[model samples]
Target chain A: MMDILSRLNNYTTIVVALGAAVLGMISGVIGSYSVIRKQSLIGDGVSHSALPGVVLAFMMTGNKSTEVLLLGALVAGILAAGFIIGIVKNSRIKFDSALALVMSVFFGTGLVLLSIVQKTPDSAQAGLSRFIFGQVSAILKRDVYIMTIVSAVLILLVILFWKEFKLFSFDPEYAHTLGFKPMRLNLLLMLMTVFTIIIGLQTVGVILMSAMLIAPGVAARQWTDRLWLMIVLSAVFGAGAGVIGAFSSSLAEKLPTGPAIVVVISIIVLISILIAPNRGLISKALRRRKSKKGWLEKGVKGGDII
Target chain B: MNPQLEIQLIAIFIATACALPGVFLVLRKMTMMSDSISHTTLLGIVLAFFIVHDLSSPFLVVGAAAMGVITVWLTESLHKTKLVSEDSSIGIVFPLLFSIAVILISKYAGSVHLDSDSVLEGDLVSAPFYRLELFGVSIGAKYIYISLFYLILNIVLIAVFFKELKVSAFDPMLASVLGFSPILLHYGLMSLVSITAVGAFEAVGSILVIAFMAGPPVTAYLLTDDLKKMLFISGGMGALNAVLGFQLARFFDVSISGAMAVMTGVTFLIVFIFAPQRGLISIALRRKRQKLSFGMLNLLIHLLSHENSEYETREAEHCSLANHLHWHEGYARKIVDKLIIEKLIVVENGILKLTDTGRTYTSNEYSKIFNN
Candidate 1:
């Protein structure tokens, strides 16, 4: 416990936690759009698809810079989103089928590429697999700066197009009938989501990153019905999970940061599902019990039943 | 038997086994469930290992299969709450379970030879070394037997419940109305998928299991609408991909399973774009042909309608027709030329006139459209 507190004041711990918190916040923000749009699992496909891009970026530039690698991840994620949309649009294959097929195939390609990179003489490729499960301890100060800038820009855009996104997410056909271009809005939303997934790859890796995108928004949704409030609450829950997860992982001897963050957020989801008002399991059950009790009492008191 | 042959046989067996259940998964739109099951089975193995303290226990398979069904049930229940959407439920459930497993491994089993990488990306090249022994006599690789067990198991279950599986997958309501329980079938299929995943995990890993599960079945779907034929073709494609992927892996000195996945994708892509009747190119070509024929019919109708009318000369001119029909000038000329070549219309001093054939065809088409 003493070691954890002393380490919390240290430079690297603060930086890593900050990075995770920012990643959580932005994922929560953009993830609300995806979750509401019923495309939450698309983030899973996009993250897996980003693997090839990260590796290809390293291969192309021979630079292990975070910005360069993430740019590559973003491009690959967009391509994956495009493929999913295209397959669902053109073929008889449903969305889930296309997502599964695309995700596995793309990750397979990444594995092949990773093997090729291993065979190469380049010693710099050693850390590339960190993107798979993530290595938050390896996150540098520069990566945090990049994440902050990207998060700011994403937030700014969300604010600027708040009304348009609101209409698009809720009722796209109505928006289209009102002369708004839903396709453009959808494309923009997908791009933002891809960007968020790419930036967070360094923290939670590809697989767990999906949880970060989903758990926060889902938890926040139980607390409120309004979209804006949900977004705000989701950001808070996500950022909180990030801090606590990062701290706990640091305190532990060999705990992995990525999965730790995911576990924390998942606990938040469980709590939200059970205890939150209105939409919570417990509250709904209580309300049902109250109504049934009232009806039974009325029946007995009025002698309407034996 | 050679080790190389054993590896190929194992790959083929796993591929065929996975493709069988994959047919139902694809048809039922639960391909993502396979993905979730593949990830959470690791947790099942871990929890089971903690209790049994034996990696090779048959109970491990049961544990993993139970975990897979639980994952599906949880996701379905979470969705049933209607608080969260189905995809969100899936996105939430698997990662949470997988993360707990990861944390447990790192925190407790870090030194117990449970490398998560090997689980996620298994090494097929090493499978031939684990020899199967039958009464003290070597019987090639153990994975070959393992995969064969799963293959036979899947084939038996699917064959025995072919009609039940078919009806439930296509129409669950009808299946229940006819005395078949969809829930029992759902859990049964989930158990089969879980065991199949466990068997294949040491060979192709979990992610490639999804490729084997979804790729072949979806590709087969594009080629045929018949369920039996789809199953046959999916299994065949899976086996073919295994052989080709093995060869490619050898040539490129890459991961064998990765190459197989890529090949699965390649085969699907080729089938998706060029299948004789149902491919993308063929579909697009069909649409184009329809458009051309519709254009020809519209041209014939226009010429027939304007024939012998006071505005015939002005309305039937190629440029005037383009303007009136709102078609591109080039498209208008092309349609007019097609009509002329078919003797449907003839130009008399820049005025278009419909022939007897054109008149009869246009009136028939017009009446048909009206009747519909």
Candidate 2:
């Protein structure tokens, strides 16, 4: 264990791992609300929409600063969310259809823009494609600092409005009658989700960002029913997956970091679903066997069994 | 055929193939399952290629079909656990399988001609170059032939199992009682979707496959309520979108698949806003018209109910009507003016009285609201 820790002592490896850990924790904490609200796939839509925003930001600024690109992504994500809301509200289209439509169109538009950017003479456009399936080794100290500050702010907001957010998530109509504006709270939650997704783009990329949001919350759900414990466990699971993913990718020769992180998180989810306490598959199977045995023994004692 | 014409033909074939099963998917409210199936099929393709050591094997389609059924089965099983909801289960399963495929392609299959990038955003320009050879001569584009074969298969299956598919989609309990197993139909349709997705994946890529699968059917859904018309219209719309999308791609010098997806969204948007019966514009207009007439009827009812009361005398005055109803003066006056023009009410001795026709109208509306 000590040898493994020392092997991971390289400065870049430590920074990248720390950044991923923070990203995973934030995704888990925020994604719990989305998952509970049954809008788990909304993150998928917002993440895909961020692509066009990133490219448009690059085109307008002619620079590759992460901050500027993510800001553009944030705006685009909000626009996509708005379009989804608009379509679902005004038309006969259901929420899932609206989500799929906006997601595909925004992503297609982004691809068209990316092709244009590739055709341009500027070579700085080279790094922009990395946002598709993130290249986490590109994380510098400054990028980590930015990630830390943004995640800190998001965590603080979530903490500050924890009760209201909980009520809003559990029952919006009840919250509305309690004079806690559900619409505003819903928007605030969306904003936080968009922020988390933007920060995570550099680590997990758009294609797999949604998995980061979903896997941890799902894993944590198996362990407990309390909201606070679920949030805490989800954050820990996410951080664990992130650290493991980053470390493994660094140790291996050809392993890609984003997919590595996703694969690790997926394993955690599978294990949780199979072996975690009362909710696990193994536990349920065992319980069923026990009950069946008890019933058979009772039947034999009553002379009802052959 | 010319390369451009061949590309257009392939696009149309792919569109129709996806749209056929897509209609049932949309009707069943399982659009997201198509998204999951398309992604997980990548795993099947990778595994099949690994086993056969060939990209063009017939077994790849079989593997992909199996994977698609597995995806649906896994999702349903997870849902049955009651721990995870349906969409969350989908989010969990596909990413896991797809990431495995990606990792496998990156780590072990790097030397092969298979590239994940082409799988994601297929290069339709090069699609025409892959010729279908039979015996000693070249026939046509390989992708076009493959897509057309699947399109025909989809049509035949849907035509033969139309009643079963419709019953299962709308009411699975009734379908099962009628001796048509809904679960079997579900897997059959899912397998068809899987095969169509694999056939189209090489030509249009996965994202556009989703667009073609859901978009045309959803647009057609807005146009008609009958399932037969919806199917025909969806297929026609799918072909139309392919041609328009191909032309748009040429005009803009963009990705052909991307253009097609965008065109599908555009057509859906247009139908959403302008469809005669179910469109947003028509619905809004109908709502506004209903509100106006409802307000007028409500005013007449109020007058009829208070025909001999002092409140009627007061409300007979122009501004008093607004005050009594707690409406703005402008709104009250507009309703009153429209009512007078319709001759539903009359001013007599500074009291509002319901005309004979107006009393009948009020009773009709009252019965419509309460008696039903």
Candidate 3:
């Protein structure tokens, strides 16, 4: 056990990685408000939009500091959010396409900027590529602090706004009549999303960030509609994926840590999506079967079973 | 442009062409099924690859399309068991089928020559380069051509079946009333969706297929009210993004899929912000202008209604513009002033009166309050 601890210390990187995963779950759980608001793809949109911010931050700072780049990423992500809302509210395009639209445009710009980064030669630039695919092993002790602080703030905000998020998610029109501005709530939701995606960027990269933001929340959603519980459960699922994926990648000398972590998250999502006891596809079927059996005894035969 | 970009053009065109059917898919809220078809088709592809010992065989497309249909059928079967939701039926069928295919891939990893990676993310770069020359033009990027064939097939089918698809999408009950079998349209759309997906798989991969299928049509929908225009505009948007996506990919040196996704996003943003009729900026401006006018009119009415002010007095002040006027004030004031000049309001010094013409606006309380 001591040896395992020591070896684990050698990759304190995985702990940071796990922290990001936990951040992901918390964001996802909180993000479910947006998701159920039927704005599920916002995470994907914002994550893609954050790319150019990262690259621009790298260019401006002459460094690849996650904190600096993340700030830039947040700005880009928020702008993308504002733009998406603007499109949906003011124009005729639907929410889904608007999200995809922002995602592609911002990500395209990021790719172009990334190419420019690749062309430049410098020591900091050497590690700049890490943001593209997210090599967890490249994590610094400082990254842990940023991730922890941001995640804690996020969790606290979600806790405080739990009822608001819920009321807003289920029925914004109702909330609006009760003096809550659905637009403000939606903006807050998208802004928090910006922060989460930026924090998770160093661990998951842009393209796969949606997988992190959505997969866990989606998995947790299968378990319960109670927002707080869903969040906590998603955090656990995300953290578990992180720790396990980070460890397994370490086990394989050749496997890259980022992809490994993603695969783990994906696996968890797959399980929860398919077979989680309550929320899983299998469980839903089993629950339906049992209910049908109960109904048969009650003289209620065949229908939607809903 | 590199060979990759050119290949991607073929990929994007085929993708855009195929995505024409996707507009219907997303609108009907069955996107997950499209995703499932993507995964389950892997089983079919692998099945064909093993049977024919050829990755490029045409049989692979047929087998894969069949598997896509089978997935839907199996899901429908699970749904009929009186025991599961449609989502669960989907969730249960695909992974099990996919895992079985994965197991087979591992079992024959050496001789299979078809890995899960290729099946999921079909090496678009190399696959597109596989070609057979024709008469003299050397025109054999067969995957693109095959996808084009499917694309045309889809377009023709959609063109012939426009009313049916529209009726069903708007209201299946209405469609059924009109003697159109929604089930047939549903399956037809699903089948076309499957064929397009399978055809585009070798060129652009599944994720891009989804992006194209959902992205541009949605963009077009934002910009237009007409569905026919939506189909045209969405396909155009997809194709435009493909070209831009290719150039953007080359500019950035990233995955074509990533670039195309970004291009779709950019196009959406532009349309969102500036699409003359449906853009945010325009709508906001229009609303701002309308609100200002409404607020000014409210204030004018309040002032004129005070104690002894006549409507003509208010009209003179409005025309003079001495006070801070709201944006909508002009519109309301003009209408009110026109009423007063025409003898609707009899002004007595600094007083206003509401004649029959002026009183007309207040009659409908519901419409007045709602501003509907």
Error of 3 at A104 (Å): 2.4
Q: For residues B217-316, could you state the per-residue lDDT of candidate 2 as single tens digits?
A: 9899899989999999999999998998889988988778878888888998899989998898899899989988888888877776776776655756
Model 3 C-alpha lDDT per residue in residues B1-372, reported as the tens digit of each score: 346655766866675775688788757756556666876788898888788988768899899999999989887876564434455455446655665565456556457567544543345567556665687665656666666677789789989999899989989999999999988888888888888888776666654566677777777776777889989888888888888877766675666655776777678668767878777778788987776556534644554445244544554444443343443445556655655676545444544555565445433432566686
lDDT for every model?
Answer: 0.89, 0.85, 0.68
Flag regions of model 2 displaced more than 4 Å. A1-3, A300-306, B56-58, B133-138, B348-351, B367-372
Instruction: Evaluate residue A215 in candidate 2 and report its C-alpha lDDT on the 0 to 100 scale.
Output: 87
Candidate with best lDDT: 1
Interface RMSD of each: 1.3, 1.7, 6.5
Model 3: C-alpha RMSD to truth?
A: 6.9
Please provide, for model 2 over A185-219, each residue's C-alpha lDDT reduced to its tens digit, 9 standing for 90 to 100.
98889889988888888767765688988989999
For candidate 1, the lDDT comes to: 0.89
Q: Per-residue lDDT for B194 in model 1?
A: 84
| Residue A20, model 1: Cα distance from true site in angstroms | 1.6
Tell me the RMSD of model 2 versus the true structure: 2.4
TM-score of chain B of each: 0.97, 0.94, 0.77
